[model samples]
Target chain A: MRIGIYGFGSIGRLVAREAVKRGWEIVGAIDIDEKIIGKDIGEILGFEEKYGVVVSRDVEELIDADVVVHATSSYLDKVYDQILSLVRLGIDTVSTCETLSYPYYRYPVLARKLNEEALRYGVTVLGTGINPGFLLDTLPIVLTAPFNIVEKIVAKRSLDASKRRKSFVEKIGIGMDPEEYMKALREGKLTGHVGYAESVYLIADAAGIHLDKVEERQEPIIADKDMIIGEFKVRKGEVIGIKGYGTGYKNRKEIIRLEFHAYLGAKEYEEIMVIGTDYEVRWRSTGTPGDQGTVAVVLNIANIINDLSPGLLLMTDIIPFKPFFKH
Target chain B: MRIGIYGFGSIGRLVAREAVKRGWEIVGAIDIDEKIIGKDIGEILGFEEKYGVVVSRDVEELIDADVVVHATSSYLDKVYDQILSLVRLGIDTVSTCETLSYPYYRYPVLARKLNEEALRYGVTVLGTGINPGFLLDTLPIVLTAPFNIVEKIVAKRSLDASKRRKSFVEKIGIGMDPEEYMKALREGKLTGHVGYAESVYLIADAAGIHLDKVEERQEPIIADKDMIIGEFKVRKGEVIGIKGYGTGYKNRKEIIRLEFHAYLGAKEYEEIMVIGTDYEVRWRSTGTPGDQGTVAVVLNIANIINDLSPGLLLMTDIIPFKPFFKH
Candidate 1:
């Protein structure tokens, strides 16, 4: 299979490396960055070996590729043109964009347009990863199939931001004081996280429930002692982390609760509880890494794109995600 | 769809009732019980109306039925001849037998023969229920599809036996003295709940891991206080319940742990934890009634049976179970 890569960043490079390991041909790569525009794909990714495929700023170069693995940005609005260009060129795509995970819930207009364009060009497009795609939302909906009825659902995911990317720490306002953190949060410079609300909406939609209201809240986790994380230092009596929650309401009752917490040294785990009529179910996993989980999910579902019908599809529409075991 | 019910017991009656409500035709009913023979199905089930169907002692009466819903027995060995007769007659079957959930693990020869007969007659046979089929095993295996690599799996289910069947109370030896309960357990009068071992085997197979050893252990849950359930009374310090666990090991490392606890007034819930290379996943459900859950699953997967290939199949081999929402 010939593959092109969009968003030549850490996740994109990981996808390329995995594809190469599977003996898939790296047809081309597209990135808007100027510094590595003409560099060899392997060299741009810091590998000593070269694959002879140069990075190009043009999407046309990737028209010959069978599928494109996209990890460019977080939202569908941001990557709309880039994805539309590839879909028009008749290329299948698997992306890690969080909002695109279930765009039909929040961005129906754009999602419909993308679906129609993909159908016209006879291509398939999917948005998936670990967080919004699996941990808090899609997994819970699928787990409720055994029950006669489900009344409520609560899903919680906690992360230790110290072990995560630098961007995560900055986004959470880790090193800032309470006043500064509050100021950034109000100004929208620091939003809690991208996928909590999306996860809530995805669950509500997948379970066929209509929520009258969807709400979000954020708070700070105060630091008790000094801490140090790769080049970043945190002082005592400051904002050490952030906790965010998104809830969906129906008939004045909160039916879905999605809680996410990321702190300097917080416990790392994910938990989902589904309250059903015949059964109430809960699932939890400890010590799951963020990057590895998302990247692995993206690469695992890449090959499944072409088999799917053209549309802005959620994880539910495709074959359930399976482990990519190499024989 | 022309449906024939074999067993004419509580579960079989439930399946027939559900199928009737869905507008399916009840072609015939089969049972060896003398008391229910020659009785109209509706009259036997205490319904005001008759459906013009009568119970018969011969399996041959069900040859014209499109499918058979079997729920008369628990062990595959006890139901082997009954199931083989249906397969030879070229009728598809869905049963609630625990051992048939994953018969290949403990009954390889019988499983192979059933598969061969099913293939020759172009019919499909499946065993499923709330315990071995869903809460403990199949749900966890299906939930793990989003991971890249899984290292270990742990599933636990606890039931409030007081709210369950009278058969469950007897099976767990509730209200019995420790000595008497042990004697019954040892004499095969009351074996531990039948599905924990099957659950472990199913998960191991679905994960593509070969377990070197699979073991089960059971102990009595002694009553701490006097309790009254239905007509059974439990005294303090007496046997009130049973706890059973099945574990699978590979190269001396415990890989799969399935624990089940059932007692009078025990806290009821189900939990599953999957520890993978990139993520650890957990799911739990509380207050699930066993009979209701099993009936719901059977009805939900009924349409999928005719679409599957002719063979002895697992829940994982078919389209994952989905809710049967009426439009």
Candidate 2:
């Protein structure tokens, strides 16, 4: 298989590394980083041997591949043109964009346009990752397969912020006053997490249930005692990280709830509870690596995206959740 | 969609109930039970009204259905002719026979013949249930999606026989002399469980790894103290139930291990641990209903069997475990 890597950041590099191990040809590398442009892909990947492919700003560099993995940004607006440009070139794309996981949830107009363009050009497109893509939505849908009916769903993903890298920890507004963190978050100066609504709708849509209400919020998880977390010193009643949640309702009855948590010294694991009439099952995971899991999801979908129907599709569209779909 | 039920036992009735809830048309019911034959399915199901379809010994009753769920016996030898007769009538089938999950494991010749016949008649045939199908095999494959390289896998399904029906508890040889239970089990008078080898092979096939050795064993779980279980009285040193295991080795190194425990007081849950190089993750589930899960597996696969290629397939074949396949 021949593949290309777009947006050569942490995730893109991870994909390239795993792809090479599979013996797939890395046809091209597309990135806007001025520092890496014009360098051999092998050098940027820290390999002693240089691959013929070079990191280039031109999208055409990826035109020769069977599929181009677009891992640009979280929001749809930020990566809209980049993904469309690839679609215009008639290339199948398995992107890591969080919003694109459920484009219609927040970008109905753009999603429709992208779908039309994909159909016109005859290429497939998908957006997925560990959170909006699997842990929160896809896994829950799979768990509901054994039930004749599903009444409600609750999922929580908790990862220790102290274990994450510096850039990822910074986004959660670590080690700040709880009130100040909320104020900055309200003013749009900080970004806690994204794709809560996407996951809520993804689960509901797969269940074929229409939601009357969907709401999301992010809050600070204050440390209760003096302790050390990474480089942070002792403190009490201070913001350590954030806990975000999304809730969906049907006819004023709660149907779905998803929680995303990342805090210093937090327990790292994911739990999903799916309840049916007189039945309930909980599926828990021994935490997943965010960036590593993103690489896996993107490449796994890339392996089969070419065989799927052409259009802008969600992860649930091709994951084969037929049992829930029947409901 | 129209469907048919080939066995009117516990699983068949469960499937019929859920299928009706989906509003599917239950075209016919076929069974060899002399007492139930010729009776209206609805009446036998304890419904207030009668369904026109009647239980019969003839396969023609299922000819009109888009798919037929064949849930008679566990071993392939017992149900091969039954399934082939349906395939001859150009009807797709989803069977709950445990041995048929990986037909080639114990019946390679029969598996190959069934595949040829399925292709000749252009229909899909699948064998699936909770143990051989999902909990031990399919679910583990799905959990391996995030890893770059997997080294070993261990899955366990532990259920409390005390909470199960009497018939189920009887099969586990509850309250029997440990020595007598072992002798009876060896002499074929008692059947504890089947499908360990099938699950091992299914996992191996998805990971694209060939096994050098596969071994399975069933041992009695002796009671440690006197206690009441259901209607039976167990004393210390008596057999409470059984603990079965299957292990697969590659090049003298163990690669897969699966344990199935059904004892009077066993903890009720399922757990799967997949370890990759420098990475490991565990997925656990609250206890799943064996019979209900079988019904779900059959119907879920039946829902999409028509769209699949014509042949005998395993759960791994359709569940989409590309990440593992890449290995």
After the best TM-score superposition of candidate 2, give how far the Cα of residue B72 lies from its true spot, in angstroms. Answer: 0.3
Off by over 4 Å in 2: A176-180, A183-189, A223-227, A234-238, A323-327, B323-327
TM-score for every candidate vs. truth? 0.74, 0.94
TM-score of 1: 0.74
- Candidate 2 lDDT over A240-284, as tens digits, reads 899999999988888899999999988999999988765788989
Q: Rate the local accuracy (lDDT) of all candidates.
A: 0.78, 0.86
What C-alpha RMSD does candidate 1 show over the true interface residues after superposing them? Answer: 10.8
True contacts kept of each: 0.34, 0.54
Each candidate's B-chain TM-score, in sequence, is 0.93, 0.96
**Angstrom error at residue A232, model 2:** 2.8
- The residue-level lDDT of candidate 1 at B40 comes to 94
Window of ten residues with lowest summed lDDT in model 1 chain B:
B318-327
